[model samples]
Structure formats: C-alpha cells, structure tokens
Target: MKKPLNAPVLIVGGGIAGLALGIALRRAGRDVELVELNSAWNVYGVGIILQANALRALRQIGLADACIAAGFPYAVSLHHEENGQPQAARHKPSLLDEGLPASCGILRPALHNLLRDAALAAGVQVRLGITVADIRDESDAAQVSFTDGSQGRYSVVVGADGIRSHVRTLRFPEAMPPRFTGQGCWRFTLPRSAEVSSAVMYHGRQARLAGLVPVSPDQMYLLLLSEEPGNPRMPDAELPDLLRDRLQHFGGQIPAAMAHMPGPEGIVYRPLETQLVAAPWHRGRVVLAGDAAHATTPHMAQGASMALEDAVVLADSLDDADSLESALQSYSLRRFDRCRRVVEASVQIGQWQMRPEPGADPLALVREVAVELMRPA
Candidate 1:
C-alpha cells in the first residue's frame, strides 16, 4: 500500500495567515506547529477595516461572530471633497441578504488576540521568539531547523510570513523584492462622535486621501494616504507634528479629529509596499501563502482578508488532494488569479490616487473592485 501523507506540518510565522492556517490544519486532523519571530504576539496599527470577504473567511473558521460583536460594523461609505463637504455615499452591495454587515472595524490588538487564542484552542503547537533557520525540502518532507537550534521534519513547510518573509528569501531567491508605491499611510486613533456613523473617505486636491473609520461605539481612527516617495522612516517624536501638518489642508470633522491627537503615541505611519510573486508558489514539499506569496496595497483593505482566504483554501486543498504536491499545486491554481486581480486593482487605485486622470472617476474604479471582491474567493 502507498505510504500515508506526511505528518506534522510546520507553519512559519504566527501572523493572521499563519495562525488561521494552523487552526484549519489542526481541525483537519493534521499535526500543526507554528513559530513566530516575536516572543510576545503583539500587533501594531490603530485599527483594521474588515471587508465582507474577510468576514466570510473568518466565519469559515468560526471567529467572525466574536469579532463582529467586539467591533463596530457599518454598511455605508461616504465620499467627501477636500473641503470636507460630502460628495457622495454608497452602501456596500450585500452578497448575502442575511444579517451580516458589509464591513467592520476593530482595534488591531483585539483581532490578533482573537486569532491567537483561537489557534491555541485548536491544538496548534505555537513557539514564540523562534523562526526557521534553515529548510531542506526532500521528496516527502521538509527538514526544518529552528533558530533556537532545534530541528524537526515536517510533511510540509508553509511560508505564511509577511511581506519581508525570510521563508520567501530562502525559497525564491530570484523573486523581485517588494517596491514602494509612492505613497504612505498615516493612522491615529481618536474618540468617535455621534455624527460619524459610516466610514468616510476625504479626497483633497493633489491626490491626498484620508479616511475616518469607526472601530467601536466610542472610538474611531484616521487614515491619511499621501505621496511619500522612497518610504522614508520618520522619527516618533516628529510624527505628531508631521501628521497634524498633513491634515491642515482638510476641513470638516478632520480638524476636530486632529485636535484630539494626544501625541506621537496616538499616531502610526507606514509607507505602502506591494509585490506579486509569480506562479508556482511551491517547490517540492514547501509552499507559500498570504503576504509571502502576494502582498498588496491597502487601497482595498483586503490584505488580512486575502490572507485568511489563503489559509482556508490551503487547508481545504490539502484535505481533498491525494498527495502533498497535488494539494500545493491546487492551492496555487485556486489562489493566483484572485490574488493577482486584487493586487493589480489595488495598485492601480493607489497610482490613480497619486495622480488623478483627467475627467476620470476613480470612485467608480473603487466600486468596481469592491463588487468584484464580493464574490467568493
């Protein structure tokens, strides 16, 4: 009789993609171990907006309801002019008429805690402050050496690591590195007001984009995207003043929100980076998923959702395939087109935001992509 499939799968990185895959694999009756570079499972950023597709993926892993309960869900998006006057508003098209809201926003730490706890509860072996030092992919298994100097042979090694994935560096040495998208995003948390009922996007002249998203009953966060070439790193002390200056050009509720900025602690800033690793996301017993395979810009707010979808699809593929190679190939085939579309569309949106096309309606592009993403991954 043929030998059974490899056992004890090893997942590198404990981020959303890694943890979600760990949960799904363990549920499929496979031995799953996950390692993270950070000792403490911490997350940065003020808040995250979970689009409907993301909620659908989380719902598959049985964590959506808990998240929705802990977050603020709203179905509408308001577009405003540079002066803060409302230009237009649209409600997300409901994919399912059921009670599920179109989208939700939550504090980043809360989402991380939920996933980490759920992964641990699902019987995943999580090792913190550790990572893969070396990986040797053989015919049937991958021999992985941890940074801690310990070693284990796993049936499959998944690189769910983030955009700067060490696993990707090791596996795809020839792949292009992530590139700056000529824009950077600034985020800060502020108290919510009664007037801020929906997610609002403020578009100023010269390709300036800002958003106010509600994360809870009493809290919201501001996101500003501006042209920042080369992804320069700014000191923490200067962040508060720099962010305030960036918002000075806008009016409406933004000025009020800017007044609430406590200091540097309330601000988070990062340049947008993106990359789409070419096909064949696997080699031998090693495979890649999530940002490791395709890291997209945040214009669509589908980064986490794409990662979650990757986890679910990968686990399901392994369960149905006759062998490991078949499963990895199947996962790549199912994922490539969908991910490419999102990455391309998001990058296009960012490009358009940086330089508006004459007489072009960029909002329509945003809406088109949103409708496309509403379909199942």
Candidate 2:
C-alpha cells in the first residue's frame, strides 16, 4: 500500500494514554488523529489520585497547571479501619521532597474533560464513536483501518487502548494478558453535604476498602473495593443502606457520606485487573501505551499515573531515529524497564492488601516501605 499524501499519525483508543500520546505528537510537530471506541468519553468513575510522578509527566506535556486546577489538592490520604481511628498524613521527604508533585485527586470525568480540551487546543483530531477494524504498516508507514470503513496511515501508530485493547490483541496476540487480581471496585458520586471532607480509606477484615473524596463543595467521589471480584447489584432503595453497612465504622466523614450514596442508577462497578508486558512495546511503526501495555491494579493508586508516564516516554523515544523500526526500538528501551517495575510492584501491593487476617498489618508495612523507595530520589 502507498502512504497518503499527508498521512497523519494514528492513535487508537482516546483514553488518557491515547489522548496524551496525540497531544505529545502534536507538540513534536506531527499531524495526528485519535480514534476512540466509545461513542464518547467514558470516565465516570471515582476520583483519580495523581502522585508526584504523575504531576512530573504532566509538566513534561505542559498540562500540569490546568490538570491541577481541575482537581483538588489532596495532599494527604486518611486511612483507618473498623476499630482504628483515622490517621491523616502527608507524603514524607522520601517522595514529595524528591520533586514529585504532592498527590492530587480529580473526578474521573472532570480530568477527562481537561485532557480532551487540552488535546483540542493542541490541535489533535479526536474522533469518538469510532472503532478500529484493522491496522497495517507498509512503505515505512502505519495504517489504521476503522470499523467506520475509513483507512489512514502514518509513520507511527500508538495504541493507547486499555486492558481490553482490540489493537493490542489484533496486532500482538502473544502479548502478556491482563491478570485478574481478585479485586473489584464500585464507584459513585455522593453529595458532599453528606459529610465526606477529604479522601479516606477504611480497611476491613477481608480488606474490604471504602473511600470518599471531595472534588468540590457539593460533590464527593465514593469508591468501594473488595478483596474478591464483585457484582453487587445495589438497587436504588438499598444503595445508601448498602454503603452504610460497609462503611459504618469509618469515622470522620465516611459514615455520613454513605448515608447519601447515589441511587442504583448512578452507581458504577468495575473489576481490578493488571497487565505486565515486559517486552518490546512496538512492531516497526506500531507501539503500545497506557493500559494497552500496563494495566495496573489500584493498590498504590498509581495506574493512571503510570499511564501518563507512558505517554510522555513514548513520545520522547521517537526523536529522529534512522527509521520507524529504529524509533520503536527506542520507545521500548525507554519504557519497558520502568513499566515492568511498576507492574511488579503494583501486583505485590494489591496482594498485600487483599491477603487474609493476621497477615494484613505486616503486608501493609512491607508495601509502605516499597512504595517509599520507588519514588524518585
């Protein structure tokens, strides 16, 4: 096949990773097109916590200020258990003072809007309601065939698709698969007036975790996590009672917050799965990003942060390599090690959180230490 006259770079999946990649390529002066499978954006979850490292990645992409503004400065996380009083604390010098941005939390949809707006501002062509049917590379250029029957090519194709990435499966079937962590989460938006003042995580015997995060004066984000996969179909009439039952002992803001949990219609439940692809991230003009490459569990709340990191690094690796093949090699070199470490660490942490009984406290301690050491020095 012949390359188009003005073939723009193609990006599959317009979630955080894909959109970020489009933005990065645009900044690098590349004509880019991003195709999203969802008819529109789908970020209707709880708040996302951005660690200092995530902020640094946004800084590289120059979207830090806007993203930070769209989110509340969640400097500290308050953790408690059924019998323990909540403990409020901030990151120590080991991480925060290391130059990473203090952890900040943002409503999922709000952050999506921020990234989408910035992409438009950067001149990225974003197409929603579009699914990719196929992708190919020829004549040193990549081609993406969409379910919409349209075809386009570029010198590079970045698959920022998520864990269920069609691009990754179609292109690289042997790639590492998403591993179930035996964990799941349910997210909902509760009225802030209900009583959650800040971010809080309440731990339980089976490591059942419930949380609330205030995104604004009137709204708060609530998420409930369980040690095993869950499919609790909470009804409208039972939503509040259900949450109250799970979070009753979580002092401070949680109890009151659960009292106003959204009705069944507004509740969203999703499972937790992590992926590990420690191999090359690309094939000639094609490459992977975001969950397509590393779908991490939320144990340390670093999945999204890692995706942002992937976006920046993928873009940085393609600086004037001799060929598209060469550029892909560079992308893998820059990303595999960092991503592998994160994947391994997240798995360990998640396992620690979900482990049964007397083992919980000791596991949490180990996780805490590992997290501190992983932060940039």
Which residue pairs of candidate 1 clash?
none
- Estimate the TM-score of every prediction: 0.97, 0.86
Looking at model 2, residue 106 earns an lDDT score of 76
Candidate 2 residues 246-315, lDDT tens each?
5665554556656666666777766678887657877666788888888877666777877887887767
- Looking at model 2, which ten-residue stretch has the lowest summed lDDT? 89-98
The residue pairs found clashing in candidate 2 are 52-101
Per-model lDDT: 0.87, 0.70
State each candidate's clash count: 0, 1
The residue ranges of model 2 lying beyond 4 angstroms of the native Cα positions read 1-6, 87-100, 193-198, 229-245, 357-377
